[model samples]
Target: MAGTKTIDADVAIVGCGVAGLYCALNLPHALRVVLLAKTTVDECDSMLAQGGICVLHDPDDYESFFEDTLRAGHYENRLESVDMMIRASRPIIDDLIKRGVRFARTATGELDYTREGAHSRPRIVYHEDITGEEITTHLLACVRELPNATVFENTCMTDILEGFDADGRRVCRGIVAEDAGGAHLQVNADATVLATGGVGGLYKHSTNYPCLTGDGCRVAAEHGVLLEHMDFVQIHPTTLWTQKPGRSFLISESARGEGAILLNDAHERFCDELQPRDVVSGNILREMRREGAEHVWLSFERVPREELEHHFTHICEQCREEGYDIFSEPIPVVPAQHYFMGGIHVNSDSETTLPHLFAAGETCCNGVHGRNRLASNSLLEGLVFAQRAADKIMRDRFAADTAAQLAVAASERSRFVAGSRDVTDVALLCGAE
Candidate 1:
C-alpha cells in the first residue's frame, strides 16, 4: 500500500452488494463503518437478479420448500444451514419490507409468489421480475442515509493483511486498496467483512457483471482462509444467445414458469422444465452436442402475447429487437454461467474461520445452497445472513472494545515516537483493519 494516511473506523466492509448494504444498515449507529465497492453500488450482480427471494411464508409450505432445496443441492447440503435459512425466510422478507422494499402483490392484495424449477410451491416474493433491483435500490438508499456509514465507490481491495498479535492468535488487521483514481490506500478497522459477490466473471459467458472476478475468494485464500467446493459453478439453463460470443443475456426461469417450452432444432422438447438447474443445463448441453446445433429454442406460443408482454415486457422487446417474435417464433437460448455454488465456507452465523472476518452473500458458502441453489434463494440467503451477522456483531460487541483499544494505542504510540522519527519508520506504520 502506498498512501500512508490513517483513518479510524469501527468496521470496514468490502463490497456493496445486498449483504454488505444490509449489514451496514443494521449495524449500531455508534459503530462507524466504511463500505467499499469495486464499482458503483448498482453495478453489482444483485441488480441483475430478475428472480425474487424464496421464503416459507405459509407454515404448510416449510417441509416442501426444505425438501425441494435439499433435492436441488443433491442432498449434499449441511442440514443445520438449511434449517437456519428456512427459519429465517419469513423474517427476512418482513425485514426487507420494513426497509421499504416493495414486493410484488397479487390481485387480491396479498404477496404474489412464483414457482421455479425444483420448488414445490409458489413461495418467491418479488417486485415483478426485477426483484433484486427493487430491494437493492431501497436498501442502498437506506444505507446512504445512515450517518455512521461511509461508502467508497470504485475502490478495489487488493489484499487483506493478517497477522498474530501479542496473544499469538490470528487476526485480520486491515486491507490494501486501489481507488478508481489508481491511488493505493490502506484502511484499518476493528473488524472487516467481505461481501464481494460471485465469481461468474471467471467464465467466458456469464450473466454477472464484469467486476465479479473472484476477488474475494482470491483475497481470502491469500490470507490462508479455507475455501470449500470452489468448482461447483452453477450454469443457468436458459440464456438468450447472440451471434457474437461471450455476451449471453439471462432469460429468467420465470419465462418457463409462464409456459415457455424448450425445444431442440428439430422442434422436440429436450429436457424437463422443472429439473434442477445443473440437470437442465447438462441436458441442454447434451442435446446441443447430439443435434450438432449452436443453440436451442424456447417457444412461448402457448402463452398469450399480451400476458408475456405485460410480465416480461423487457425480454419481449429485446427478443423482438433481436429479430425474433417471441409470440410467433422460437427464441434461441443456451446455458450460460450464472451463480457460484461454492465459496468461502461459513456456518449459520455467517462467520468464517478467520478472526474478525465475516462473510455473506454469494462470496460465502453458508451451505444453505449445497451443490446447487433453488431458484430465488440467492436474495433470501443474502437477507438472512446479513441479519444474522448484524445480530452476532451486536451481541458480541466486538467493534466497541477493539475500536477503543486501537484508538488508545494509536494515541500513545504517536506521543512515544513524536521526537524520535527515523527515515524508515516501520514501527510507526500500522496495518489495515
Candidate 2:
C-alpha cells in the first residue's frame, strides 16, 4: 500500500459525509488534510437525510428530548455520551449557521423547529425536506475555500496500511485507493479518520446509498479493530412501498411529524403515531404479519392542506405522480432498512481504539445512540463530534509528528515507484474483496 502512487498529507479523512466535512472545517488551517470519497461528496448518505438536526433550544425541552432518546434506545445509552451530545448541540448549530448553512425560518425570522414522533417540542431545524442536502452543500463550500484541505472524489480506499515503520513503532502509514479510472494510489498521512456512513446496504432492503456497503467497518476489522453492537440496525417506518419489493422509497419521518397517520389494511391506525421510530416500525411489522398483508398505509389528512402544499410540495407532487392523492387517501408504506446503530467504537472525544485515529457520524458508535436513534439526532451527533475530535487533535499537537511520518513514507514510495514499469489501473487497485 505504501509504494502505490504516493501522496502525503498531515491528516487523511475517509468518506465525505457530514462527519468528514465538519471535521475538515474545524481542523487547523495549517494542517494539510486529504478527504477521500468513493463518489462526489454529496452522494454520501448524509445528503439523503430529509430530517433536520435535533437539539434542545430551550431549557424546558431537555428532559423530553433526553427521555425520548433513552426510550428509543431501550435505556441502553451511555449517559456520558448522551450528555456530551446534548451539551454540544448549541455550538454545532451556531457554527453551522455561521458557516452559511440556511435553515428554515418562521415568518417572524426565528428558526423554525418541527417536532417528530417521541419528541415533546418543536426542536428540529431543517430546510424544507432536504436538510442534509443544504448542510452538505454549505460545508462542502467551506471546505473548498480551505487552503490546506484537498478532496479526492471518486476514490475508494481499499485498506488501511498499519505496521511498524522504518522506526519500528506501530503506526498507520497510509491507505491503498483505487480511483475512478482504476489506478492505484497511496495516500499517506499522520492520522486518519473514518467518517464513512452506515451499513444499511448490507441488508437486502435499505434506504442508504448503494455504495454504503460497510467498507469502513470491513477495513477496520481487517486491521483487527474491535467493533461493538453490530446487531442493532434501525429500520425506518413509513417508507413508500412500490411494486418493486425491497426498493422502498423513503417517506420522511417529517411526514408523520407534520400529521400523517399510519393505517393497517383495515384502514385503522395500527400504532401510536407519536411513538418512537423503533416502536412504530416494530408495530407496523407485527400488524403486517398478523394480517398477512404486504404493506400498510400512511395518510396525510391531519396535515392542513395549505401547509402540505407549501411545506411538502415535493412529497405531495411525488405522491400525485405515483397516482395517489395523499390528502384524500392512505399511501401504501412499509418499514425499510435505514440507520445503523452500531459502528466503529469510540470514546467521548471520538477517538477510535487505534492511536491517532478518530471517527464520527454514522460510521462510529459513540454510544450516544445505544440500540436506536431518535429521528434527526444523527446530524447533530456528526457536527458535535467533528468539533470534539478536531479540538482534541489540535490540543495534543498530533498533527505535527504525524505529518513528518507521512512525508517520509511518501518519499520512500516515490523512490520505489521511480524504477517500476508496471503501472496498474487505479480502479482495480482496491475494492471490497
Candidate 3:
C-alpha cells in the first residue's frame, strides 16, 4: 500500500477508444485529464470498426433516419436521444473534418456516402473501408498533443471508489487501477467517465476485442448503478467463418450495401439483404438450419471490381490471404455477437445514476439504439453523446468540484491493497478485484 502511486485530475476517462478520446478532446484545455487504455491505444474495438459514421443527408431525411433507427431498435428507443443524435450528426462530422479526419470524396469533391442495410438512402460517410482507424488514429494523435491530457496504457480499472458527500448522498470519488506491472494506482478526479467498450469478449465469436469483457457494465453493476436491457445484444449478420479460433473477421455490411448478395447452398437469394440486422441474422440462421450448413455464401461478383479494390482493400487482402477472392467468388459468412445495446443507463447528458460519474459509447445505454442498432449509427451515437457529456461536465464544473471536495472523506480509500480487498472493501463492492 505504501508503494501505491496516486494521481489526481479534473476528470478521469476510462478507455481510449473513439468515445473516450472524443470526450477528452472536447473537455476544456484548463482541466487536467487522465485517460486510461486497458491495453495499447491500437487495441480498442473502435480501430476494428470497418463501416463509416452516419450523417444527415438533408433536413427531410431526418424522419427517415429516425425511423430507420427506431425500426431497427423495434421502437423502444428513447425519442429524445434519437433526435439528439440525428441533429448532432453534421456538427460532429464537421469537427472530424476540421480535425483532419478524411472521408472518401467523389471527383466533384463531395463526400462519398455509402448505404448499409436498413437505411433508405446513402448516409454513411467513409474513408475507403478503414474509416474507424482513420478517425481514431487522428483523435489519438490529437489527444497525445493536448498539453492538459495524459494517457496511460496497459492500465486496468479495477474499481470505482465510492464515498458519501456531506449531505449523505453516495457519489463517485475516483478509481483503483492496476498497471501492466500489477502495481496499484489510485486516480482521484472531480468527474469520472466510463467510455470502456462492450461485452464482446464474453462471446465465443465476436467482432470486438477480447479484453472488452463488459468491464464497465460489470463494474457499474457492482455499484448498484442502473443498467438497461442487458439481454439486448446485437449479433452482426456477417463475420467471415473460419476453422481457427480467435477474433472473427467482420465482413462489413457495406459490402452488401455495395450490391453483394447472400445465397444459400443452392445459390438462391432468400431474404432481402437490406433489412434490419435482427431480421437478417434470423434469416441467415434459418437458412443455415434449413440447409444444414455452417454458413451462407456472400457473392460480390456483381460489384464493380475497381470499386472493390479501392474501397475494400483491407477486406480484399484479408480474404485473399484466406484463399478467397472477393472480385471473383463468394465468401463463407455467419452471424456472431457484434454489439451490446444495453449498459450503464445514462441521461441525455451521459451522466450515470452515480453522482459525478458518466458513461458513453457502447458502454452506456442512453437508449439511442433501443432494442437494436441501425447500421453505421454506432459511431455517430458515441461522438454525439460523448460531446454532450463533456459539455455537461464543463457546465456543472462547480458541482464536480464540490464532489471533488469529498475525495478524502474515507481515509482508507487508497490504503486497500490491489486485488487484496475483501467484501468489505470498495473493490469488492464494485465487483472488481
Q: How far off is model 1, as Cα RMSD?
A: 8.4
lDDT of 2 by residue, 1-433 (tens): 4446888887889989889989988899998899999888878888878878897788777777888788888899988888888877877888889988888889999999988887777799988778888899899888999999999999998988776654575766667789999888787776788898888777788888878888888888888777889887998997777776544567888888989898888889868887888899989999999999989999888999876776676677777888999878989998889999898888889888776677888888898888989899999988888878888778756655688788987787676567556565222232222
23-74: candidate 1 lDDT, tens digit per residue: 8888999988899999888889888888678889789888898899999999
* Number of the predicted model whose TM-score against the real structure is largest: 3
Tell me the spans in candidate 2 whose CA falls farther than 4 Å from its real position.
1-3, 164-169, 245-247, 398-433
Clashing pairs in 3: none
| Superposed model 1: Cα runs more than 4 Å off | 163-166, 398-433
Question: Candidate 2's error at 266, in angstroms?
Answer: 2.2
* TM-score of every prediction relative to native: 0.90, 0.89, 0.92
lDDT of 3 by residue, 1-433 (tens): 4788999898999999999999999999999999999999999988988979999988999999999999999999999999999999999999999999999999999998999999999999999888899999999999999999999999999999888876899998878899999999998987899999999999999999999998899999999999999998999999999998999999998999999899999999999999999999999999999999999999997789988988899999999998998878899999999999999999999999998899999999999998999999998998999999999989889665667665753334555544444656765644686
Q: What would you estimate as the lDDT of candidate 2? A: 0.83
- Say which prediction, candidate 2 or candidate 3, comes out ahead on lDDT: 3
Q: Order the candidates by TM-score, highest first — what do you get? A: 3, 1, 2
Q: Pick the candidate with the highest lDDT.
A: 3
How far is 341's C-alpha from truth in model 1 (Å)? 1.1
Better of 2 and 3 by TM-score: 3
